[model samples]
Target chain A: MTIVSTADLLAILPELLVMAGGCLVLVLDPLTAKDRKDWLAYFSLAVLGAAFVVGYWFMGALTGSPRPAFSGLYVLDAYGAFWKLLLILVSGLVILLAKAHLKLEEIDLPEFYAFILLSLSGMMVMVSGTDLLVIYLGLELMSLSLYVMAGFKRYAPRSLEAAAKYFILGSFSSGILLYGISLLFGRTGSTTLAGIRDGIAGLPPGDPILLMAMGLLVVGFGFKVAAVPFHMWTPDVYEGSPTSVTAYMAVASKAASFAAFLRVFLEALGGIKESWRMLLVAVCIATMVLGNVVAIVQTNIKRMLAYSSIAHAGYALIGLVVADAAGTASVMLYLAIYAFMNLGAFAVVTMLRRGGLEGDEIDDFTGLARRNKWAALVMLLFMFSLAGIPPTAGFIAKFYIFMAAVGANMTGLAVIAVVFAAISAYFYLRVVMVMYMKEPGETAGTPGYDVRVVASPAAIAVLLVAALGVLILGVFPDPLIQAAQSAILPLK
Target chain B: MVPIFFAYFALVSIVAGLLTVSLRNPVHCGIALLALLGHVAGLFVLLHAEFVAVVQIIIYAGAILILYLFVLMLLNLKTEERYFHRRHAWYITGVGALTVELLMVLLASRFSGAKGPATVAAVEEIGNSTAIGILMFSDYLLPFEIVGVFLLGAIVGAIVLAKTPSPADLSGDER
Candidate 1:
């Protein structure tokens, strides 16, 4: 007989707004005129704007106090709020990119916006989820939505193949995660993250169930993060999925998953640091090495980005390896910066993929600097950012993570990560070399390459993100660093 | 008090699950899955989950199995048609099933409790649908709505995917 209070509703207003917006878009999709498919874009943009407004409202009250907003399911604190705010911002940018990208692909999908919101809703839940069960549920919600988004282009056989593979692999990972949860639940008799912390503290050393559950859970998360040995699905999936979906998956989903990983490992299981930290370091090292090396050989831009994502997961895992507030903060900063660089790159690539054809191969962009200066420059920015070169967000993100690793006295791992980053730079620089050094080849189907029509919206988003991300995080990094530090405050 | 119902239900359900996976014929698999669904419903009944049993029968047996059968009839599938089927589908399915058994062994060692998991509050109250529904509406409300949202997404995806006019071919036909 409990009455639903406005305050309670307001606590989850962002999630509610996202869900409502998604449904409203879905409902309004078919009822609209055909040329007005772009209205779906406007509707989604409006919804994200409203979500940002709500996030702003929440931020006004954020004195860094952690409140169990929904009877302890969600902890409304700086950390969760920070991730949520970024998620809201990223959701709109990706959606904005998709509107144009889908039109360029000649596939008018109003539902695409709705799906993005759904996935965004899932990520928000995951980042804010204080309970392990809620975490699993959010993870599934995100995974399922993403599975479809990957295969949205049903006409393409490869896309279908990619979807099937992703589905099977993702479901297997979910099973492993759930099994891990069951093991943890059996050992602790509690599913709450806070309760798990207490239960682990009470348990004896060399606890079998705790160790096993941790192992299984790490395996599960390792798949989502696309680290080594568990990353068999990444290249195929990234190559198979549409570029827009790939960008969202690579940046948004990975960020949210890492956010949850940070919360689960650092917050709940903080006491057993020595045990889990070793495994994470090993995984981090492996991911960094493999992602960079394999990416060098990739011909497809999507596959290369996929491998880069894996490497960045390695960078992000640096945050986990350190297991400190600074490390956590660096992760938040890295993720925000990454969304802009990665999504912007993909958005431009999607627009360039004209004539209902797939994107141009690496060769098609030969002398892109001559063909489309803006896109070429944007690509150069993305490449440099990803390569951890000077004056870009990517550099700052990598520096912060590496510095955090050094702070934790893991200079050896940090040094290894630096070497891999250097190796990764070779491939990224090669893309730039293709654009600037080489001549534009006899690449056919380059008709829809005007890019002025396409580049403005995507470029505006990408330039804003890539430029600001690189500059602000690099030049005026203190505020961002502080925010990143504060964002993890809830966990501690 | 009613170990017979529990035992019978568990035994039949397990066997049906095996049959469902093991059977080569699609229709037979549907029927086997149905059998499994029924036994699970019986277990629900024994566990004081009358509503769950009814819902289980309705959803699993009625809806899901029917869909399976319909798909089978529609596709006219001769066999499982799994990749690497011609080489060793039966053999692989056998090995795959054995591997699943091995996994069950591992899972039991890790997750299962002795005798019954009657310790949980949800278990002690009842396995009925009402308790689950109450939990869904009261505690797990967000997840419930999210699932509904997921279903909506799925439907939209299905429509998009199933809507077929080859753009390449259609371009020529477009007035």
Candidate 2:
């Protein structure tokens, strides 16, 4: 075996930064006083910021060829770089959101910040890895942190339930994924993407064993991304976890999983596209129909968005179904837009927390326009974007994905997606309508007039960034689309 | 001699595995699990994977079995007469069908397909442990380090979940 070289170490510069910073913070957190826990948030943010900078630096360095490091276990390429930046950006905003949230909810723990950074590191690793083993390990690292973060409010029984449900289901999925990987390894005699590609090419088309492994892998990744038939845990987990954690799970975790998902399928298993594409098409249809149709009846805002995010995953799978470079690029672009819009919507959810109020029920949003116009307006923008309304980034994302699907002769799937997209607008716009048109009711002991939901400046700042990102990407999508296309260059 | 030992180990493992799952008493199930683990280790030893066999006995039969016993004892649960859950007939059937399907497919493929290439002789020349160590430290250094991060996350998660909540945490915002 070759020795670990300096170049290999340099190739994972962003991950190294995250590890060192996360560990340093984890070590220092206990030594610090309890009142000073807020400092951990800033320190974690600094770590994420540093990692983002390193990722951008690497992206600049990724001009000609993707760099294979640690004997092809990981590849530092533009595709990985794009997802790394997105994960880091989403995580940093989450930490910002968490700071106010922890304070508002009175669960001041320094370990929460450390978990975020650790999880963020895992996400970075997941995106960069090309080997199945490395990808699985990265996924575990990411998921373990999230499981803890979900139950960060340990005093709350609901939070504990969420964490328990997520842990049981998540570990089950990991087992399935590992079984698939082992089966693939058995068939191919390799775990690396390139090796798997060569192995698949050597075999006949749609070998039964290889197809079985591919199916298991799809199910595993589907669970991670909250695709249907595997998404039973999403609503409960999302509704019960701390809202900031829910946001991270909804966007950052989903994006990171997709990053590895695209790599493994499009790179390693691309030769067997016909074998896996049909399975994905069925899953995409089920996910869109179930997620959108179910979401319409949800009264709880978090549960509603949980289903909404599942629907969005279905739409994004449209891109994957196309199984081409443009399709992959569209998925990337859609996720970036999705990260902003979904995180922004969850940020508003986090803002609704006050003393003795959870603010998750859809009725909590009634007449929000009269009370907090700015928040209501931000909500409107995110809602419009999420529903694929014109002049919003969501629209452009859906358009690009649909166009890619059509270009690949998947117009039938695209039309079905558009119909589902239209169905999703009802639930998303209902939140808007409640905010603008409906009057606040006074039917309960808890007066609607005195529901003082306080949002910190930091929370408002996250919302502003998300709203601006969505609008900017919506209005001038050319640059981001081009970037997404460029990111797919190395993969092609 | 090897064939006879393999048959003995396989029979013991199969019986123990069945008992582990089918036993009504929790304590009996735990004991059965220990036997199953030990017999599985013997099978691994028969396959020349001595390192895995030893680790299996030490980890599964030794530590994990003890943990299971502790949970079982602490719970002191009665025997569950209903072998299957009442509300989960469909779930059980579906899972059973899928398992049977997977078993059939795997078995069919195993018998029909050509065997994989033999392990590199270099691995046998060196100890399997040494070979694995070298590859893990060198070729898979990145994943090794990432596992460290995963462990760290797990440690924090355990602490966060099990730690007692203070009065200050339950109260409203202090910021």
Model 1 regions more than 4 Å off: A1-3, A353-356, A442-459, A489-492, B1-23, B35-54, B79-130, B166-175
lDDT of 2 by residue, A376-397 (tens): 9999999999999989999999
lDDT of each: 0.79, 0.87
Q: Could you give the interface RMSD of candidate 2 in angstroms?
A: 3.8
Q: What DockQ do the predictions score, one after another?
A: 0.25, 0.53
Q: How far off is residue A475 in model 2, in Å? A: 0.5
**C-alpha lDDT of candidate 2 relative to the true structure:** 0.87
lDDT of 2 by residue, B45-136 (tens): 88677788899999988898898888777776765434766766687689779978977876666433333333646657888788778878
Question: Compared with the real two-chain complex, what DockQ does model 1 have?
Answer: 0.25
Most accurate candidate by DockQ: 2
